[model samples]
Target: MAEKGMWPVYGHNTAVHLLQRTLPSPLADNSSQRGFGGPRHAYLFVGAQGIGKSTLAQVYAQALLCTEPSDRPCGVCRSCRLIRSGNHPDFRLVAPVNREGAVDRSAGLLRVEQAATIIRDSILSPLEGRYKIFLLQDMQQANESFANKLLKTLEEPPAHVILLLTATERTQLLPTIVSRCQVREMQPIAPTVIEQALGQHWQAEPKQAQLLARLAGGRLGWAVTQLHNAKFDAERQEQLETLWRLAAANRIQRLAFSEQTAAKGSQPQLFNMLEMWTTWWRDVLLAQANCIDACSNIDLREEITRQAAHLSQESVQKYIQTLKRIEGYLHHTTNTRMALDVLLLQLPQIV
Candidate 1:
């Protein structure tokens, strides 16, 4: 059963309601002017990855396509059914692609050729519904040429067409593109809200739900995906165990691990590992402060508390800061080995 005031999306009630108000009433006599003044032709949803931008956009599109008498989407309607099945003729999703035109799995930048293809598609009329929706996922991946290719359509899109773009950050996009659409900034959801949804919808065990909620850092979409990803839990356990072992590792052993990690992994893998390390240290800091309830690694409370007792809170805080700085450098520099070596050397030696 759905919760009170719940629309298809979880959390972000304000965003759902705001979008509902912005849509034209389906009961209105003039259906032809639905996208004219009620909701603008173009919109940009800015937020962190997996924060539900694309999910919300699809729901809003379904509402627009529904033939029902309400402003909201009717799940039973033909249009909504088509959308739910991802077979809607008028809806298109454009994402980043590789050189061969296949969608990139590594989340690369949008290619110029892909932008040209979308421009050609925009000139067409809707095949099955009153409006043609073009959902642009990760517009921040567009380079200069790609962004330029989209300007013509954005400046004066077809009357029957609506453009929806999703980006991790608005600043990553060109100013010209940003100025063309109404911007909607999505914020992080609460852990409690995510926890409740996990149990009710995902049928997760209480402890599993609690752990996922804390690790989610307010992104319900991310949390849900992790539940299904088999490797996620395995990697989490592996990483935590390694850190636990390193707590008592000698200088030679730590340096050996640094060599091995630097030799075997790519820059992206290093980035992810560093993020895990950062979170673990954050838990240690929280444990030191006796903020047990606030710790992300609540399942590892006993280990965290024991470690916290041996480590100074100030040192842990400083190490966290160091990781942040190294992360910034890794993002911009190519000297991966040097950075990883320095990071491992700074690993706190606990008795």
Candidate 2:
């Protein structure tokens, strides 16, 4: 998880240390608990899913608003507690909201109304902390109109307001939005590091830790979340097993499975399955090429290795390319059934 006195943000030591160095040091006798040199007006944290972009942003926000003596975020402070509980007046988070007002990331769209509110509220002075922080989670989902409306604020943010944005990729956002904020590209955590943190911090069993670490694919947040979600783990195992079975299943059988998945019509879940499928083949490719060390699904290496031996390098490469194209296509269209059926039709049948 986290280091002592700091937020439970594991990995990204260099980024963490760089962030800590900017805070006002009690030893330096600066009354400004916020920072020595003022923090940037806006920051954009970019990475893949569950890669700690939001968590890292929240930690930085807490550190800025902490009222404790320590330079780092004291999780026990009123400001820190409020931030954690999402009750802090100074810390406002703007994400895509459903009709129910709950976050619905699957089909969520960050509206222009939310953008307007953020821009309007940003001018006010802080209520509790020295600075008001606006956490814009998942900026990529915002339309171009929303991005354009918010561009002015990013270009000239108020001194007392800090905008923290998270996105899967910088390219998904407008170039104008990307250029205004300081960008932090978080890297994947090594499996070894993840295993240690799980064992030492989360008290994960040695056997369990090793598997989750490998499955995490360098995402500490995913590993930590999965620790408590046994049901999801079981589902993942079933999905992987189903993926393998597809290779041996007849075309009609595979198409039937695709039909079943398409009926569910779960965009996020569909994408997740595609991603899992992509990684599975990639691991097989790695195993076939004798680069087993580079394989992510270590616990499933035996089955992956067997398939690697059965599949040709050229066919594997072709399928990987097709899957990539399908992924990009699915993102732009709503024809989930057809897209998934196309994917199933392209599957390489096992001998």
Best-fitting candidate, scored by TM-score: 2
Local accuracy of candidate 2 as per-residue lDDT tens digits, 89-122: 9999888877565787667878888889988998
Estimate every model's Cα lDDT from 0 to 1: 0.82, 0.84
Q: Write the per-residue lDDT of candidate 1 for residues 1-351, one digit (tens) a residue.
A: 234644678877877777777667655423455545566788999998778899888888888888783657887888888888888888888888767778873446787887787888778878877788888888877878989988988998877778899998888889999999989888998988889989999998898898999988788888998888889888888888888787688877888888887787576567767778898899999988889789998888898899899999889998999899998787567777788777777888887
TM-score of each: 0.88, 0.90
**RMSD to native for every prediction?**
2.8, 3.0
lDDT, model 1:
0.82
> Measured by TM-score, how close is model 2 to the native structure?
0.90
Pull out the clashing pairs in model 2.
none
TM-score of 1: 0.88
Clashes of each: 0, 0
